[model samples]
Target: MQDRPTPGQHWPITTWQGWQHFATTPPPTAPQPGEPPRSTEERLAYHSAFVTVRTPAINTLATQVRTLMLLGRHQQTTARPSLIVTGPAAAGKTTALLEVGRTCHLAHTRKHPAPPGLAHQQVPVAYLLVPPGATAKTLATQFARYLGIPTTTRMTQTQITQAVCHTYTTAGVRLVLIDEIHRLNPRTTTGAEAAGLLKDLTERIKATFVYTGIDVAATPLFTGAAPNSPAAPASSPAAPSPPATARPDPSPTSSPTWRTPSTSPTTHPTHSPATPPTSTNAPPAASEASPASSAKQPSPPSATAPNASPRKHSKPSSSTTSPKKQAAPAPANRPKRHDADVKKSADTPNDEDFAALYDRAWDILIFARAGYLDDVSAHYDEVLHEIAQRTEHTGSLGKTDIAALVVWKRLTAQTRWATDLMSLPDTHVRAVTEQAVTAVRDTTLPRSEAARTGRGIIAELPGLRTGDALASAVLTAAAPQRMAVYDRRVQHALDTLGLTLTPAPGRYGRYLQLLDDLLSHGAARADGWSARDIDTALYQMGANPHPAGT
Candidate 1:
């Protein structure tokens, strides 16, 4: 018999069985001559593959949503309180909701065998997306379908609502998540009716409502502004009242140098030039001639005296100028004026308002490639470096270059289409590239015309559809500085910043303009970051389901 081949030997296989055995067996462990065990790149690539970067913003928001869900489950109330998760498009609102739903579902299933005598299984959470332009009837039907209730074409809205309530109560559902609520048009009559139906359900059902949407705060539903109901109070707390004695004198200018006596226990007698002392032996009343003469003698200059004081008070003015000169030198002796100005500006009411909004409304988590490298898995740094090295060979990215990136990234929702696009012939790929270049260069064309050109290119590609993500990706790549990617994530981010884009097919240009405005704003532009970088940050923040610092 032939001697068996050693583990590291590369002996020729003579039979099919030998070939199969060779294929199935693990690779030899022997190291090659002068070869190190594992390179830094290899190790980094390995770590980066498994690392999921989470931000503090995402964690806090998720925790808040989860806590609210749990509270709703155990609370005893006729009208269950609801939560609104509003943020920019693509900022992980749906992801966070789904995560909470999954946790609730798992907890429900773990108690698989209900306590003895409990006839039905409990569904701790129920989730559904609101269809675009959904009406009262459509919403009711959708809710019914989620509850596994059969619906007939003739079923009335009232009937469907009742069925949904009955099913939810029977299933013991404590939380209901409604996503894509931005699709619900409150301007329409049907939309108003649908909102009312949802409100009524909250009162009728024991389940708490958790809504996720892009700029949901702008909607009447979350704004706490029902038709005939009072508007919700502002999120800011009321400013505290000043101490009564510390309040400014009502007529500071009328009484020049009158000193107000302190009411404190440690009070001391005080005097001012404007007020004359009264003694026990002095006359109770002054003669009219004496008052006229006193009035003519110029009273002490008040603190509120005009910048150009009367010539008669020149003596006191000279004394005040000396103090002013002293303060000027003191300012010079102290820190830089600009630094003090910055501090004062930072503490302004406008800054405080922004801070409050950032704390409350801007709760969405943001992720960036650079951020991922900061104390993240050591492998990610190398991975990012590799990506940078590979892309460096490509000339400065233009429309076509960005198109290639989008294609490689597979920005489309349809996996199969992305795969087909990736595997397209070199000629077809070149054709798409040229089309992108032309679209970018044709600035004179109207937005609709440019969009038509983009759509035509998408149509040429097999299995591709003309949607916002695909179209916007092309334009954004073509002009990264002038344009932004218009998808759910971008929309959601804009919404979080208090800018709501109308969801219309013809509003693509408007969306682009709004994104440009945001990037151009003084505060946003102060960091000197590029539009593409900002877009990436927005995408990461919007897409992170699990925030790090919860």
Candidate 2:
């Protein structure tokens, strides 16, 4: 059997829970309805003014990287429609397009790490987010927050759109990166509320758009019936019709058939046996007819001979020759990576796959949580077994360290797995794992202490309970774990870098939680900082950046 990558083995960056949080966050409010829309003339005036001012650098390469920014500016200059980008988180999609803003004369900003060199640019660009829990009205309200437009200004969706369109056109705002795009998938009000609001905003805005979010939610946007597919536009001209005779007729009677006439062959009036009819019709007959034949015989009077019959007309039958080879049809949609893909990747080890193992392990962790374990002892034992297995792998990075981190990351969005990890009946194992997790969380202490603490905690908790049962409780509580998980590879990185932190108290979960909090706090306050900012910063701090930036 092929080796399927365990989801527990590879956890993707964002979790199911993360997506929910994004959708539930409320959007800012908007102005009243029925307000008049800004006039076309007004919008044009703004575009004209900005166009006159001239923008900055144009990325020489200009690949698909800048689709959103180019689109925004195109709309501003040509008065064309706007667009929305939708995709998984940490795809580096936004950064690619944001480069457009970097080069252009117009100013724009990212949510975090701030837009580079904001000091320059003819027109000032500002960044705004589509806050959590936003509806159509609220989304409009948030855009107003940064555009210097007021939510209470009492504008209808259409009117608000016009004013905003006008502002971008006039102000030369070429692009807007709507980070945390998954938030648009709200559970409240049948979900269409958020979808409708986004559709409305795209229609109303003159600026180009860049949407960033989790891969699953973005799947529908890019793959569903939406126009964002990789397919060609529907409006293109179709292949020309073949010749009329080349087509097949539905009616049998209309089908072409070859026919022959019943007329008998004609005989020469007199075959002299010495000569043929050529003699009579030949040049000698020209002696009888042609000194005047130079007169062209009056062009044969433009008429056929009276005795002449219609000649047979036949079309060659359709040939059955083998068909010509054609190029394979291109897929109309983007390719998606699934579990099978992971296995396929593992079989063929490359730098990319090697780097992605940690994430792959995380996925395994999620899949493991489909059931709950009640016996605390069994749970801890299973957890230990898992850790031990991870430690067996050989690579530059220690398998144990990576496994620890993977477990911690997975448990964040799926805690039940850890609490009910295994079916063993040993209470001591649970204690050790818990101790390991706790030790990691208490950043100031050594990991050895945390391991001991976990053991102590388990010792104090009574009973040789199965870890599975506790896992169920953990899942039921929906409590996020506090520890940041670290693996030996991670430890090696820290050690090599000469950092003093020790993994004595907790496992990877402790470290992950701590880092998660710090980054989350940073992102929340930064307003325009994209999820990428947090990821890049953390990876740097760890001194172990994912090859592709994950």
TM-score of each: 0.32, 0.26
Mark the regions of model 1 whose C-alpha exceeds 4 Å error after superposition.
1-59, 73-77, 111-120, 224-550
| 126-185 per-residue lDDT for model 2 (tens digits) | 345556755455565666555456544334554565666676557555445455555543
Model 1 Cα lDDT, one tens digit per residue, 1-550: 1123457755332221232233234323433689877878865554443211233333444454455555555544333435555555554455555545554555555666457756235656667768875756677777776655888754556777889888888867777777786675432233444555565566567776766667654544443332201011110000001101111234655331112122221222231112221101000012221311111111121232111111221111111000001110001111222222222333453664434433332222222322211112221112222222232333123333434444433343355765666576656665664575467447787443564465455456643354455555555445433444555555544454444556544445555443333333335322333444444444433332321100
Model 2 error, position 443 (Å): 35
Off by over 4 Å in 2: 1-100, 105-126, 153-159, 186-191, 216-218, 225-550
**Roughly what TM-score does model 1 have, to 2 decimal places?**
0.32
Best by TM-score: 1
TM for candidate 2 is 0.26
Alpha-carbon local distance difference test for all models:
0.42, 0.30
Worst 10 residues of 1 by lDDT: 320-329
Root-mean-square deviation of candidate 2: 32.0
Worst 10 residues of 2 by lDDT: 235-244
